[model samples]
Target: MSRPNILIYMTDQEQAQVSFPEHPCLMPRTEQFAGEGVRFRNAYTVAAHCCPARASFMTGLYPSRHGVYNNVNTHTAIHRGLNDGVITFSELLSEAGYRMLFSGKWHISNHENPCDRGWEELIVSSPGDRQSGIPPTARWEEAAKVSNDTRGRGQILRPGWGHYLVYDTYPDQGPKGYENDRDYQFVTAAKEVLPDLTESDTPWCLYIGPNGPHDPFNIPERFADMYDPDQIALPPSYHDQMEDKPRIYQRQRSQYWDQLSEAEVRESIAHYWGYCTMMDEMFGEVLDALEASGAAENTLVLRMSDHGDYCGAHGLYCKGVPAFREAYHIPLMARWPKGIVQPGRDSDALISIMDIAPTLLDLADIGPIPEGVAGRSLTPFFNESSPTSWRDTLYTQFNGVELYYTQRMVQTQTHKYIYNGFDFDELYDLVQDPHELTNVSDRPEYQDIKQDLVRRMWRTALAEKDIISNPYATVAMAPWGPGIAFE
Candidate 1:
């Protein structure tokens, strides 16, 4: 069998439900792609932020091992980039004789050249003026030098309701021209480059990362007009009273979305939906290019987002420091027309972004997954047959890039436990409260469950080599617990 060419289509801050098969209104092309591929119902990002998530996506290692604790860009200088010692999937793919290409955001590290990590070709999307285009600092000390000061450039925060909004028409209006819009440029490059690469003898891998459906929710007027703000539906958890939720949740609401009236929240959600449709259109363009190139059959395609946005869920705007399902659970789909005999199935297996590297490497017939690679290969889940052995729980971690906070989470089929190192821990019974509106952690009845989850988190931390500093020497005891028996 001939080796397949790989195309990874990645978006920023996209929710799993936006492109879900049930809702084809927002991202029609993605829904169609899912119809021809397998959609992971419970896919998640190891970390909820940009740089850490992207680093895990590339290296197949958790943020703890990869060493990217936060977003790596102009603003975050303290933890700027991925460690140089880590090996990325691109590097291994390149070594395996595939032509590797990376376009769009490579926020992995402040490494001078991406070529060093294996992509021979790189086209960095300009982080437009609205995004501040704030250049990254040279070293860790520089972060303290300009604490919270975007180096004279302004922050991405807009004035109204703390939701970043630019109420303007599109096309050549901003510093980055509409024609030069990052997403447009990324698609244009892919359209122009894909045909030739498909025709080449060597199998090629192209990683396309587009910054979209994120915030600054400004989009072309056409898409912005798609949904009427009055008609937009609010998330069930939008008015989360913030009752049993942690202080961080309260602080985030006060800091960002507390002032937002119902109308403003609806309007923001409308803009977000519009932005999603616009991103879907861009994705359609690439699908058109692939079909035109006649390489659709031989190409293995992956579509996913780095993380999800709050989009008014829990009265929040962007991703919160806490482990909210809206922020961490994301869309993940894979399509290989020639290889996958039976597609259009949904797998409930718990998976993470870190799995992408190992899965892709496996699909490409690359040998022995690198030692210390922390993700499982998902190739087995492609077929129609169900695997007897699969993970019942999924774990994720979050640490602040701007604010130093530690949060680790372990989610089972029915429950979720979030340990906030600084404040209160959160335990949600998913079966009872799918929306995660209540926190049952402090309840005496659920102490056994919470204790078991805490032990799980500790074991996971040790397995992943995560550096979680816990003051309680109690956790140092048995793998299960003290006198408390694990149910």
Candidate 2:
């Protein structure tokens, strides 16, 4: 039997709920796709931000070990390298003779392109709006100049478009067009590569990473006007002010939300949904091409997001600041016609994006790459009728000066415990308060509960080596409350 071809379609900053309960955008296609696969309901990113989370997915390591801690202060070379001891799943697959192709965002390393990282073919954009200095392709340069004229910002000087400048040039192509922006470039590259797939007998892996719904909220006019701003429903956390929260949360909210109005927020959400829909349409195109090329039945299709966005959730505009559910939770769907046991099933098991590599390795019948990879394969969850003793807790971390303090959280089915290695600690009874509006860390009645949670968290930290702590010692800390203050 031949190894299954792999197609990973990843989106940037898409929330898990965007396609839930059949959202207006992408819901139809998403539902059709989910029917052919396993939909992981509880999947989350190891890190809330882009670079760290993406690096973790690529290398199957945590942010601490990967060393791509944050977005602004970190460089890709600091963590990922061609000669670095770390080996990516793509490299492993390529070494095994799979033809690898990558299109769209390559935020992992500035030291080398995806081709250097083992991809046979590569079409990637810069990490972020930081100017690449490497002149873009003719189409990209033309788009940049047009974008500059549209925004009156002199030139499209950024590597990727920034959020603050939404009134910029519009992207005409949906997913498969000749437009030279990152999204269209990815689609065009995929279309160009499709014919070759039909002639090749070797297993292939094509990564399509789209930069939609990330920022600038500027899609083609047709997609942008798909939804009316007045009809869009705001998130439950949408508020004018996030009172009784940490100072950092409040400051972030003020910085972004204070400048926009209720209508504008709705408009942004609508535009985001439109972008999502456009991406979904693009997915359809890719799938169609795969089927036309006779690779559909043998291809393992995976759809996921790097992290999540905060579309007016908790009075926040973007992601990376607040560790709320909207920012970390992501959708994960995988379809393998031959390998998957149960199709159209939804598993609520706790999973992380980092698990993708291990899962792929297992499907390809490859040996474990190394011992340092923190993620485990989720194949068992897909095969078993009922998963027993599956991961009981999910962990996430945010480490950067921008976040003010390094924070790690351990969440179980019933409770969530957060430790901000600085001044505050948070405990939430997820069963009772699903919204996580109340912090019960300081309550005297939950002292025993807090202690037990701390013990469990310490054990997890020690086992995962995610945090350095002595399990023998007990944590002695006061509870954070409404009156408690932080800088």
**Candidate number of the best TM-score:** 1
What local lDDT does model 1 show for residue 397?
A: 71
Clash tally for model 1: 1
lDDT of every predicted structure (CA atoms): 0.72, 0.69
User: What is the clash count for each candidate, in the order shown?
Assistant: 1, 1
Model 1: lDDT of residue 396 = 80
Determine which window of 10 residues in candidate 2 has minimal summed lDDT. 469-478
lDDT of 2: 0.69
| Deviation in Å, model 1, residue 263 alpha carbon | 0.7
| Clashing residue pairs in candidate 1 (N, C-alpha, C atoms within 3 angstroms) | 172-178
Residues 266-295 of candidate 2 have per-residue lDDT tens digits of: 877887888788787777777888888877
Candidate 2 matches the true fold with a TM-score of: 0.73
